[model samples]
Target: MWKEAAAGASPDLEFRAPVDAAALAEAERRLGRSLPGQLTALLKETNGVADGYGTDIVWSLDRVVEHNLQFWSPDTFPGLYMPFDPLLFFGDNGGGDQFAFVLTPERPDIFVWDHENDSRLWAARELKDYLHRSLLGEGDWYR
Candidate 1:
């Protein structure tokens, strides 16, 4: 089980899931982009929720898109389903500047969706580091 301390809330959050190679490949095809190698490798090893101490964050690929089926991808990892404001992390660029964090079931790093910029940024450290320092802090609005 992978767990991390929530900055907004002191309590820890857990994200879990199982790795599905077929689904991952399909997600890559749907998104028309290859996932980071490290992320792919991690998914191959651990096929369960990969965040928090005991919380179930990441859902199985098959069970991931219940809330937003339109945006759901069988190949993509399911998010822990936390209710954070996406507008806080994503900018207003007519949906082009939006992004989402896809937590894998195997590792702590996150897969980001830079919709407006059309790119993906993989974290070198644990996802918590990026979330705590970059996304959640009060710095220049545009970095």
Candidate 2:
């Protein structure tokens, strides 16, 4: 389902091998939280999604775990930005902006975190919608 959705958006997307259950479990363990169902299913289908120019539209399991851990850490970010505890980052624009799902309310909607302005705004309804928009459109499609 994920691969087809991505391909439909753009055949140029590069897909990595599927992540195993053990890797998923380890990722969850390291993050101290369960992964979202759509993200988990997508990772099980393919570890990551890359664009033609090598941007990580959806990061691999290991990258996902590492990035989230860093974001969740209070010391990792400067006091200039808002707390990242409520966001589960999974992807980024080629620029500094990142995409995430809200975990505090456990919603499926996707949001974009603008690294420059520190704004968290709605990007898509869910993972599939995010994929279609981000993959098919150029630049910050969410805006």
Candidate 3:
């Protein structure tokens, strides 16, 4: 899905190497939570879409860990106000809005965390659907 939206003649859309299982496992270990299978699988295909790809930007594995920890860790001051179990941001709108998945109960449902309004809206229920919409540029969630 993202492989196309993220693909382009431009250099910014270049695909990164797939994340190694050991690294993904280590991330999970550090996070103490199992990553969504679909999300992990997608990342395993390509770490993430490159920069300047709008809301479709899929952060790299290192960025994933960095982002999550920056927002989820108490040691990081001014961290995200909420807890990590419920929200794990993976993409950005190139603005401030964030796209994330809820993990407390372990569902694949995706949500948009609006930066302006501090609202969480359900975007898609499955990773495939979300990726399709993203590739097609069909949703308002990105902006």
N/CA/C clash count, model 2: 0
Q: How high is the lDDT of residue 122 in model 1?
A: 57
Q: Which digits, one per residue and each the tens of the lDDT, describe model 2 over residues 1-143?
A: 99999999999989999999999999999999999999999999999999999999999999999999988888887787899989999999989999999999999999999999999999999999999999888777899
By TM-score: ranked, best first:
2, 3, 1
lDDT of 3 at 127: 67
**So what's the TM-score on candidate 3?**
0.78
lDDT preference between candidates 1 and 3, better one: 3
> Which model, 1 or 2, shows the larger lDDT?
2
lDDT by residue for model 1 over 1-143, one digit each (tens)? 12333334333433335367887788566544455453344345443232233322333443332323444444453463332322112112122333234433434444344553445555326533443433333322224
Error of 1 at 113 (Å): 9.5
Residues 22-108, candidate 3: write the lDDT tens digits. 999999998878788877988988987754444445677777777887778776645445455478888766767777888877788
Off by over 4 Å in 1: 1-11, 38-128, 134-143
RMSD of each: 10.9, 0.7, 3.7
Error of 1 at 110 (Å): 9.5
Residue 96 C-alpha lDDT in model 2: 94
> Which candidate leads the pack in lDDT?
2
